[model samples]
Target chain A: MKTKTAPVAVDVARPRPGPLALLAGARRGRRKLGRRVVPYVFSLPFLTLFAAFFFLPFAYAISQSVFKQQRSGLGLGPPTTIFVGLDNYAKALRDPQFWDGIKRVLLFGAVQIPVMMLVALALALLMDSAVIRFRRFFRLAFFIPYAVPGVIAGIMWGFFYSPSFSPIRQLATTTGLPAPDFLGPGLVLWSIANIATWEFTGYNMVIFFSALQAIPQEIYEAGRLDGLNEVGIALRLKLPMILPALVLGLLFSLIGTLQLFNEPLILTRLSGSITSHYTPNIYAYNVAFVDTDYYYGGAIAVILGLVTFAFSFGFLRLTRRQSGV
Target chain B: MRNWRHRASLCLALFLGVASVLSACSGGGASSGGVVQLTFWSFNQQITEQADLFNKSHPNIHVTALKQPSGPNQYYPKVLTAVKAGNAPDVALIEYQYIPTMVSNAALVDVSKYGANGVKDQFVDSAWAQVTQGRAVYGYPQDTGPMGFFYNSATFKKAGITHPPATWDEFAQDAVKIHALGPNYYITAFPPQSTGWFQGLMWQAGATWFSVDTAANAWKVSVNDATSKKVASYWQALVDKGLVSTVADFSNDWNAALNKGTIASWISAVWGQGVITGSAADTKGQWTAAPIPQWTAGAKTSAMWGGSAISVIAGTKHPQEANEFAQWYLTNSGSLSIGVKEIGWFPSNKTAQQSSDVNAPQAFYGNQVVDTVFEQAEIPTTWTWPPNLTAVNQFMGDDVNAAVANKTPIVDALDKLQGQIVQDMKSNGINVAGG
Candidate 1:
């Protein structure tokens, strides 16, 4: 076997020598070069867009975070932008409202993420099962909510959550049940969470469903042969296989929770519970726009971004370690 | 292969070049007929219509009005961005409360140079006070919203109340009597987010929260002074006693309460008359206007709440034309009539207030001359807003809401707000007194 393989390897490795062979070699070299350069050429547009829209703004925000706009005595002149390195960041860190917003979102995500992901996972599993009827219709129905824009969804849910106009409240009253104040101070966060879940569960469900589809059918067959039922197969085989997708979904939810703005902003008119500083993103927006203090706003935004990145990376690392990858 | 690559790059370059040129050509479509074109940003469509009227009358100068979003939430940020970009409109409509902020930021032109001083006597003293800082006049007052009590007459009659309360003592007694009618009923809703309305109350209570001394170049921030604290404590007691509901203003809940006759009155502004008329149309002839209850009996003093002004922005090349249009839009009888009749804005010009359209009886308030009540309510002692008024108002609202919801003392909230306003002002390099 060694003698046969050695001659084959030598023949494959041998260089061509004739003029026609040299011409062919030159052609192959050109083709190889083309193959190496084509992908970068194809990606140039995307790279340009990413740099322009994402990287440039990110760099600008970083620079802006270090400077502050100061006015003269009595603030009766045009504000002068001056360099104040890390001062804005320090002030942001000291702001009670900023911390309160961060804490509120952290609490919001802690509860919202698990509930949203579980519902999405359950729906995905149901659709992936063989016993389900009208699978296509069910999938479409589950995914339809992901198509609705966030602002439109927030407005729609605002009407439903409104105590005066909510059909839910009317139904509750007619049925002799106590009416729930969904927009009250204690329940407003959960109300926001419910809207977010309704908006994004379908999106996460699609991710999970696609991941489930990519699984080899042979593993399920083996599980069936081993006397494992559907639930057992889902828990033991399918779940572990889709762990990476679950982590990806979790990371997306984590980042999204930190950037909460639109729902709370619209809901402010409906509910007194949502203040200008209800969430970190809202606080940053109020600081930058309402207060016209973009320096501190930029600092808060950068800090939030860093926190999101760190949390997601740490989570990914933790999951990889637990999986012994 | 190299030739093909070269041709592909050339094609891409050509495409980008064409696209940029197309985008560039699509902008600046203003008329260039030797007419000086001036852009004006306004929150109301009435101003745009008035500008159209101006355009028809003036052949040499053309004014284009761009309607901005109504509230400060979106409007001020857009103005700031435009000003920063140095591409702001020549003239813009700024609310009276925001005039100090705009002036302090130097976003407005000193229109006194353009005959603004000559027309000072055209506007009400309080309205003029809003636009002028010392000798520098920044804008012409467009409208004012003096505070008033919009009460439900039907509810009052049902509760056996004969007249509107003349004092806080009488008001509190009336609230108790009104609440006695039913468990679901309250005298009024104290909306936590209604900082402007609350400010009007403070104003009526003689609380000078902000006072600027231009000669000294200093600001007196007395947000939690004795008078303001008294106002806070008084409301706190009412809220604590559950005599007033904590419904947010402009909310469906508040409207539902009003429509159902659960709330007896709205302590709002002249502009609120239109809002109530529109939102609670079923309660049309049942509603009536009265002076807001005073701290002392038989007092005629009142305070201003919401209003706006028209100003030339600092960077405008056509300051003369912009000021001319502003003066015309505000002072001209034809323009004033249009604003009063078409737009719901209460005129800031004394002559405009005296116009027949304003003096005419309205069907909304049971044919009462509601404008007369507002006219008297624009008292000279109305509170002046500080340069940092927006931030101060927001902090007050947030803290007040927290106090109301958490059952904490409202005076404590005021104290916290006072500290925050001082810190915020000082951080912005404003010289703050009583810090």
Candidate 2:
């Protein structure tokens, strides 16, 4: 019995030495090396670009926001940059024009986003329905405006908004109706909203339609088996299925509405309604480039960026909780 | 092993792509040669033509003229960015009003260092004053936009008005008589967006809104001074009375009004004659030129509206060559003649002003010697612009436009303009007084 026990104990004490153990060790080593190197290799280009364009500029802008370039006396000599912590931010916060710009954009977004999204969703739903004809043509036609650049689109819409040479005004006059002053101060914001809706609705529609296509056929079959009609299915099943896309679309539109710049910039010369400080971005741009007050502009930009981040993060958090994502 | 090789190749490709992009960005310097290549940026077509002429004449120096967009909104930002990056053109065209801003920013080199002072007597005093900061000359005067009145002669004739109004009171009376003709007709269109023109009117009224104290090195802004208020109220009354239409200048509606005989006249600069002729071509031989109507009777005072100077940017590699080109292009009789005759840029040079090309009658203005009217209208008036004049002007435009839209009183607008200007100047680190 002692001899048998000693042989068993010696067998257990000896380290495992076989082809299977050796192969497992080699596999473990390979996976460890891969775990270390694979992510860097995959992310190198993106990381480089991100660091160069986004991170570096963002860091610089933050640093610049704390400094002020002061011109002494007559401002004839070169300006001297000095550190003025929080002064620029304080000034921006106190500026009426900046607040006015924020209010204008908020008001614009409030009315524009709902109308734009509703129209986009309706078009996307129609295109997705079996009752629709020439779906591809309609999709392509709707998406074409997104292909046109913002500045060019603004210019094209500006022609229709012009009181002097507008074809719409001509039609109104010929029809014995009062020619609407589209570029008048009272109506210009709506005109700008119209341009924004025209430009981005098509883009959002495509996003929604693509999302709608991804809905499983079995789900539709199941809904139909329960006596759900096309509209009923679309309202209950398809809409819920595409809620993530809708949220994403809403976030994009919200960010765009906050950062309004190009349309007002191009419309400045054509209409009196658009001022140099028409929107926050325009105001920051004027302060930075036009006024040559880089510090103040940087502060405004940082504040605006923070506001955007807060809004987006808040929205994402809310949606995540609601959808249990 | 294959995957590693593929990754290596991808990394190499990205490196090459980045290198190529960097190389592309680093391009655009003097080519490796004996030739001195100078880059000139201008919004004026005449400058491009003249640059071509210079290139043909001087083989040692090659100038590449790049055309920028005309408006300050597009062009000024590009210039400012280039100036900041130290990659600005050798020579650039700047409006006279922006000279102080450029000077304060130290964006222009004193051209007097390159013998610019020698041609000081060649340009009009006001034009010369615009290019000089204290004692240092910064640029060569390119063109002058002496203010003048462009009237529709047929409209005046139909209204039984024999002569042009010589004073504001007579102008107002004529506006009433012209408005009585029909609902469509008015004496003139009061352009709400014409801040420069409005400033010209204020200047003619002896209103010096901005002045520099060289000794103390301070800027004085007096935007809502008595003379300016008088000018504002005069126009405000006319606008409120519906005697004048509040149309924007250089707009399609304005041109339509001019062509349709609804707007009888334009109190515009010399450059406006060319614009009117081009835009209202069908009204040829019906237009006439006169001095801008005065605030005081028999007063010969006038003010400049739009003019520009060719300035050498501060860090130009070829400053001497740029100065040479600027001097030659502005003062040379041959080049000035082309600028005046072909391009219709009213010359600032004395010789160019006296040239037969400028003195010749324009058929569009019914054989009127419009250039002579413009030349005679260049009176000695105190016109000063602050370093933050652009900001001040923007505020002024907003207030004035508000007044025009009837959202605010003209006096209130002027008061707000004054406060905003002072506040803006102070915020921009400028010394301000008389707030």
Worst 10-residue lDDT window, candidate 1 chain B:
B22-31
DockQ by candidate, in order: 0.41, 0.39
lDDT score of residue A50 within candidate 2: 83
Give candidate 2 misplaced runs (Cα > 4 Å). Answer: A1-42, A322-325, B1-23, B27-31, B158-162, B177-186, B213-217, B259-261, B378-380
Q: Tens digits of per-residue lDDT for model 1 on A254-274?
A: 999989988888888777778
In candidate 1, position B419 carries an lDDT of 91
User: lDDT by residue for model 1 over B74-122, one digit each (tens)?
Assistant: 7877787677657788889888888888876678999899889898898
Candidate 2's displacement at residue B396, Å, is 1.6
**Would you list the clashing residue pairs of candidate 2?**
none
Backbone atom clashes (below 3 Å) for every candidate: 0, 0
In candidate 2, what are the lDDT values of residues B1-435, reduced to their tens digit?
688899889887997797688567655536447778888888767677788889899887888888888664457767876887678888888888888888777788898878998889999876798788778988989888878888998999899898999998999999999998987688998776677888888888888888876675677777788888899889888888889988777767788889977799999888888888877888899999998898778877888887889999877888888888878889877788888887788888888877889889888988888888766664655567778766766777677776776456777888888888777777668786543
Q: Is the docking of candidate 2 incorrect, acceptable, medium or high quality?
A: acceptable
